[model samples]
Target: MPGIGPSIAAHLDEIFKTGKSRHFEAVMKGLPKAMFDLMEIPGIGAKRAYRLTKELKIGSVAELEKAVKEGRIAKLEGFGEESQAEILKSIEDTKAKSKEKRHLLPYAEDIAHEIIEWMKREKLVARVDPLGSLRRKASTVGDIDLSAATKNPAKVIEHFTKYPNKKRVLEKGTRTASITLPSGVQVDLMVETPDAYGALLQHFTGSKHHNIALRNYALKKGLSLSDYGIKKKGTEDYLKFKDEESFYRFIGMDYIPPELREDTGEIEAAIDHKLPKLVELEDIKADLQIHSSFDIETSHDLGESSMEEIIQKASNLGYEYIAFTEHNPSRSKHNDQQIIDILKRKREVVDKINYELQNRSAHLRETSARHSEKIDQINYSLINMNKKNIQKARPQATGALATVGRVFNSLEIDIMPDGRLPVPEDGMKTLDFALISIHGSFRLSKDKMTERVLKAFDHPKVKIFAHPTGRKLGHREGVELDWPKIFDFCKKNNKWLEINADPMRLDLPDVLVREAVKLGVKLTLGTDSHHKDSMENMNYGVSVARRGWAGKDNIVNTRSLVEFLELLKG
Candidate 1:
């Protein structure tokens, strides 16, 4: 706690004041206890320990070795002069203390979300955005700031005090409040009215260095700018800005997004404002491939989805399409009939829905024309039609209902096995979508792995690669991706990459994903879900995509149903 006075106290305040205390576990998990102990050494101070921990990731004796092997400890300022001898001596000195650490990002994310949600509800702040190093997507973050635009200041203070079920309010002020939460996440809630919110949000979201640069820039213009507002350096002629965009305009800068708010050259970039549009979640059109309960042997499920359920879930998700890329019969516990039956049953259900929906259209149109207010009501009832009634009515209304809106515009199969892709006798014009996957090649050499994947991409009928790395969470490192070569081939061949959404296998981490994007690779995220429950995993993939800075155009699924089909056809 020695080095933890104001800054550490503030960080602790964040944990205790907000529900996000759990996020710190990962950060602490990555730190060594011995590093804390080292701070207490006779000559060592918290600054030195902070420096050592920052550079070496040293917590105990073992990490000392790791830091040395990683060439981090030797690179520190004073240590660099006699790095060879001093680093070794430092390791020997701390060798007695040791512990293990892990990936701390999850914990940080959890805490960040807590503060975010808290700010939204308590502060009445709309459109709160993350800023600073965390926004930059760094592997680690020291502390976090939440910037929110609110109409009222007193409400902001009240909300922060109430939420995370705060244990105690250590300090309270109009703009800022310090409090402790039950979980030990110390937090500070800073509030600004909507008038000053945008500019302040931009400033607060930046690193100290970035803030300094902006300040210096303002000074050069004979203007003084702070998180509150901007005004002439000598006069109180501070032009009160109404929003973030106006703030940028006042300073002759383009609006800076949260991600690039780091202390780097973002200020200059904002001035030039030539930032490329970042990819967003709405851009995806189709989830080309996913699993079902049928492919349970190699996958997690033993049975496939009831055809009706799968289509309904896809519809609910606003997906124009979804593919059932079940395991091939040759390699799995399924028989040909089982696979056939699943498809057969799915088609039957879809046909039945389409038939009923068609029949209801004429009546729906007549009702809506006479009673325009009843349109949505009529459509809702039509959509709520059950399978039993639809099936029963199919024969009676088959002819009339043929004009109804189709319940399913897109539905397809995903076939996966070891042999060459299934192509039509006519060649290259067979299936709606063909997704290839890697299931058993986790241990192959890099070249062999690369060769197999390259072959799959070259196959004309193969539309997308599923779970490209075959990595499972908390279990295995994926097939080591030879990205430089693989991405090169994908770019040239026009192959799409899958950011598998299975929680255990978010294979294409944002780092590799960004690299793929830089090389002009179109990325796709598939739930690869064995159950309907898993379809929600796409959100996680989106998170990874957001971290990678993907844009809608970069993702294939954000297209419309028609466009998606065309993509498959191409």
Candidate 2:
């Protein structure tokens, strides 16, 4: 946003509004999708990638590497053997660097899904599961690992080799196999009998430190651990477990959740039966951050879907409520009075929609009760026989207490450089609550940033701090802040922190979430969704919460409307 000029902004606005821009079309005239990926290679620019792809049909780095090895690039115009050698060096450098980097959790999950779903179709495979950091739901993962349960290990291995998206089969054996995806990420698979599957999963799923700690704990009991099973120190015989619960039970501990298997004192907690009931996706009842197409003339991007459309999507997801926390009206363009007027207008619209949803749900419930009563009065025996059908005849309501669409007219207002909120007191009062965030001046010293955030929290309506760390997973680091002080302030002042569910910013990262949970701080989950469909990202937030060992009690969004309003009052 800082580097963008007026012309660039105009171009973007045009594309957003109409999906077409003459200048953009001219710039992208003859390029194929592959050229974009090719440009990502270390030394290749757009012009070079375009020429190479068009001239030699080298659509990927792998293909380009092949051409370079074949001496084909040296023969091309303006490229001699020396230039070819330089390109080869760059390619090698890139390959080595990529291998050291980890893929994002969603990307790894998708790759695992392809493998597990494919293996499930094999007749010999009874159960398949992901293993390693993937099972722990880490933010990023290295190469994928999975395991399958089957008596016919050889057949399962054979079936794995025939996977459709596999670029190459690295290895194949009677009980194991490995493959490389076309994307160059490797996938490893293991096969085990049903009786031994639990041992395999537990062995592979825990982190290296977790495994060592668990093994050492078992060694104290004169037991040795292995993928096959646990065995006595002096005995060759191994005792098999049919499931993970049994595996942990035999070791005299409760089953440690996969997310908590990070050697983070989880083993000790499990032994004492003190492990928290980790939060699940089902515990989520609201998506606190949403943007609807109710325009208030903000400088930032507007929502692409209407509030009605978002409510309908939330209904399908079974949410009790959602907050439309759009960016506050552009400060430069609107007067204080204008901003207040716009916010008041938006609140009225939310109230009108809530009225309709409440009335509709009530009418349906009343009608359902009447129908059930008539069925009973008509014939007692028939009513007994058709009770389930009578309940089915009634339309199902989306909310927990016979209501839905309890919209929160919230604003994601920016925390100004000097620690002031952009919105005036009157405009702020219109919001059910305000969520403050720092969008710029990320270079502030730790004390300044801390003071800046604390000043924003002084406002009574500012109930949550959105994307507190402001980190973009692979692109940029977050601003400097005194997190201990920040967490302490929130805990004492009854302010909530946000876990932004956007893939780019799972902010208030897992480590911080864990700290917040430990310090008695409450956190909320929001998709930061610009469109209705992005609401589904709430699951990723729940994943972060669970990884932090948060229970349902720690997440504010898990609260119903009544309970959430009570917190706001406090």
Candidate 3:
């Protein structure tokens, strides 16, 4: 709709009705479909696709790979050894991954920020936004989708094609352009006028089913929806909006958060004015899954960051509290008494840190009083008003939250195959509380796995279940468990579930998180950070919580230290 002039539009009605124009067959008569597949490989574009097929009889990816391996491709003019090697590596990479491979959200964010900043400076671009899965905060995303608000579509497309590190421009058109990054990740950009920006965002930020259901609902209301704007059913008139909130309000419902637009009863909730005030990163006051470099000799990876370094970083983040939930000392390496001694030593170190924290408390409060900024990172409705603001909300420090009053001395204990904790009871006594999790034996049956976890929760000090699902994205599926029973146990026994914030393990995923929310099971956020730099991952955890429809009240770590302490005592 954006680049369609009246003259070109007049010829597209029949094409739209039948999916293609009659000239399509004539235009594609001699083209090999395999060339399209080859073009998907990073090192191959349209010209290369044609050259490889024409000269080497390379049609499919397999045939191309064979030709490459046999040194047939390097012999071609305008191709060299370096080019051949690059193409071979790209083919090998394509072979290694599943067809549905998606980049993790953080990785995609890095690329989007760099590219979006580039696009924003273009004179023709009035605004830029991420669309679809990235906008919805999905844990993993496919192609990075972007939209530009502009008065000049053609100029924006030309500028976008010139992105500095792009491997090739896949397609260039009047309304849209696609380019592949060096990593083979595709980025798609669309141009639209500022007045219809909201319509464009809502139309494409879809989780297919959400849009389908929305269209059905609109049809019943004698209205039609499109990227251009809302249309009256029997007339050609359209109503345009510049923001998503206004767009939803015009439809007689509360604005649905992008994270909740997954056809998961969000439409019904919006109509009833029951959409959640979802949790925000600023509401969080603690990071509960930190590991310290203080070595008690762990069974797994030891932390690379020291407790003092982590505290400094946490203070910089405006946190009021944090925990040192390092892995329990290896049971095989240390007997029960040895484990007790190690844990007691850790407790002593934590006590010293807490003592220093108390000494700094008065100064911390004074500093906070001096700086009025609340560090409003991840503010609600992170849409049009400010794109750059959402990424880096504030650099000013709020000292009141600095040097959290005390560092909770905690341990992430591994649950043995038989449901026994690796940490002895005497050792656990030195901790504020413990987080138990399944590190192995993930192949156990659903009923048995649930039983094992419940048994682990039986320990009075085992207050939270860490990374409850035990999933490693892109590698391992989470262990199976009976959720109804698990939720009941946590709700009734005051046990908490953790949403691990690590990019590789965003466990207790959004779907389970929503279920836990319904059953009133409290959840906590943990970055599982071994390095201080990883502490920033807490934002990703908050994203998962928001996606699950969790509000500030549902997340335990959102509480003030006093509130969290009271709950622990309860």
Give the whole-model CA lDDT for all candidates, comma-separated.
0.61, 0.87, 0.88
- Kindly list the per-residue Cα lDDT of model 1 for residues 194-262, writing each as its tens digit: 666766766766767767888888789888888778878678755667676788778878876555454
lDDT computed for candidate 2: 0.87
**Residue-by-residue lDDT tens digits, candidate 3, 1-570:** 899998668558767788776666676777777687788889789889988888887756667877888988889999988899999999777645532569899998999999999998798899999998999999998888999999999999999999998866667789999887778787889889888889998999998999988888888898898888899877997899898888888887899989999999999999899999999999999999999899779988889999989999998888888999989899889899999999999999999999888878976666555443443423534545565545535444455445567689999999988899888778989999999988999999998899899999989999999998899988899999999999999999999999999999998899999999998999999999999999999999999999999999999999999999999997
Provide C-alpha RMSD values for all models, in order. 13.6, 9.6, 15.0
TM-score of each: 0.58, 0.81, 0.80
How much is 104 displaced in model 2, in angstroms? 2.0
Error of 2 at 66 (Å): 21
Candidate order by TM-score, decreasing, is 2, 3, 1
Model 1 alpha-carbon miss at residue 345, Å: 9.4
Ranking by lDDT: 3, 2, 1
Q: Give the TM-score of candidate 3.
A: 0.80
Q: 1 or 2, which is superior by lDDT?
A: 2
